[model samples]
Target: MLSRTLLCVAFASASTPLLADTVWLKNGDKLTGTIKVFDGGKLLLNTKYAGDIPLDWKEIKTLESDQHLLVKQDATTGEISKSLQPAEDGKVTLANGDAPKTVELASIQQIMKPKPVVTDLVWKGNIDAALDFQRAENDTDDYNIAFKTSATHGQWRHNAKGEYNRESQDSLTTTNNWDAEYSVDRFFTDKWFWDGRITYKRDTIEDLARQRTVGTGPGYQFWDDELGAFKVGALLNRTDFEYSNGEKDNFYSVSGTWDYNRYLIGKKVEFFTNGEVGKPISGVADYSLETEVGLRYKVTEWASLNLKAEKDIISGSDNGDLDKTRYTAGFGVAW
Candidate 1:
């Protein structure tokens, strides 16, 4: 039995010369039989017994052999041979034009393999619950409640969110708000994606009046599989007053955002900034800018506390109209 094993080993070694070959460097250098890989700026070759060989781009002139060839010219890929050769003395030969030039094989830089895009599917979703007791100087102090949930599957995603706020003065009237937003994400690549969203908000002015709005837009999401994500997009929204004296209005709104997830701290955390530039396309409302910046701290694995301050931007409008700034801080949980 041992003799049989020894015979197999000897056979493998004998055939290794064909199955594996050497890559000759123009600088009187050589690499034994190995597999080669090229990355952004590096060159590499791997040998079964030895390991990987790294080479500098400047050190190589051309890669060629009787069997295979890989050469890069003007920039990369100067093929020294008719076809791209694989696993020779070098991963590929640096194409320096058709001229003969002396290069140091020792100076050859081995390339590194590209970071493989993980095919492993990862899915994460969460719900959020929050309550807010806010103080507005010279205005109404109110309690606000909100909920948000989101999930992603491969290139497609879904997000749902809703908020309800009950606003009351120290002794006067009360106001109530109900809002909901839903979005779908479509991916072009891991780095680039577009999403579509529909949103609606209804406000009851504490028994005095009610107002509502509906809108939709296409947006971009820069969601890194690692780190956090940011989104930028536009919305065409219109508001109608059912029992209020305010004018009805339709708006062309552009928005941008930057966000970060909890990476440094073990606890969940996120920082976000967003802004919108809007122009009233119909009815009578002023063009405006609205910006907000905030931070969120995880209260649990599926929930967090959110705090935000916002300001409105006004341009091309004379009157203040319905333009106002709001500051919001709240805590919410999810499972």
Candidate 2:
């Protein structure tokens, strides 16, 4: 009976998945967890007891992992190793089947799990919605929703975004508008790309009822990583405007666009902003600008609370000048 009980306990332990990664700190404390990624001078570790933890790379003495990983040294391309073996303090060994390479910890630039295939696609995006209702002297209703998504495969990336808003007071509509845009980028190098985009907007209660634009430009990606990304571009656009009184105008424009985001406090909070500013060559409008800045706080792994402000301005439309500003607080999901 005693032998049978011991065998049963051993079997259960063998069946459980092992947290095979280990990191040793300079202060003589040892940690066991799965290594997630290392970037921006931080190494992320996943542990069952404490969740994901970010450790400063400088504080690490040595680390080892049995899982296959890609280790990037300095700025060179990464090499995959079957496992990491502990070496002397401040050094590690990358063990393959026949070749074992030892390198200093300070020389390692990044570490991450290797993708299953070289051309694997990655997709990420988020959606947010807000609603307000008042039932007093002046009944008011307002609704707003926005979404943005992107997919990247190899050297190509595709992006799409849209927004809808409506507001009513005393059973009368005061604002209604919707807009959508799609863009594609083709990379010629790691940090440089060309982009083509098309956009359309419609306003049901405004004099400038419709706007359409097509543009192409060159962009520079400053950086993209687990923490955040920022990119800027300049475009030459052909735009058409239609007014409610059967008036139409078309013109060429020069524009600049930017998108930026950052994560803070161990990825609990995010700051984001994206916008476009343009000057029309034909004087259809003195200038046009559309922008939104927002912050999101993660409430859970996938859900978040968001606050945002948006501005839309057309300085000299044919029918009249248009300027609007809106503030929103809402909940969202991000992946």
Q: Top lDDT: which candidate number?
A: 2
TM-score of 2: 0.80
Cα lDDT of model 2 by residue, 110-200, tens digit: 7888777752345679999998999999999999999999876657889999999999999999999999999999988668999999999
- Candidate 1 yields a Cα-based lDDT of 0.51
Worst 10 residues of 1 by lDDT: 112-121
Candidate 2 backbone collisions, by pair: none
Q: Assess each prediction's global lDDT (C-alpha) against the native.
A: 0.51, 0.90
User: Residue 187 of candidate 1: its Cα lDDT?
Assistant: 65
Clashing residue pairs in all predictions, respectively, total: 31, 0
TM-score of each: 0.49, 0.80
Stretches > 4 Å off in candidate 1: 1-141, 206-218, 235-243, 250-268, 289-291, 310-320
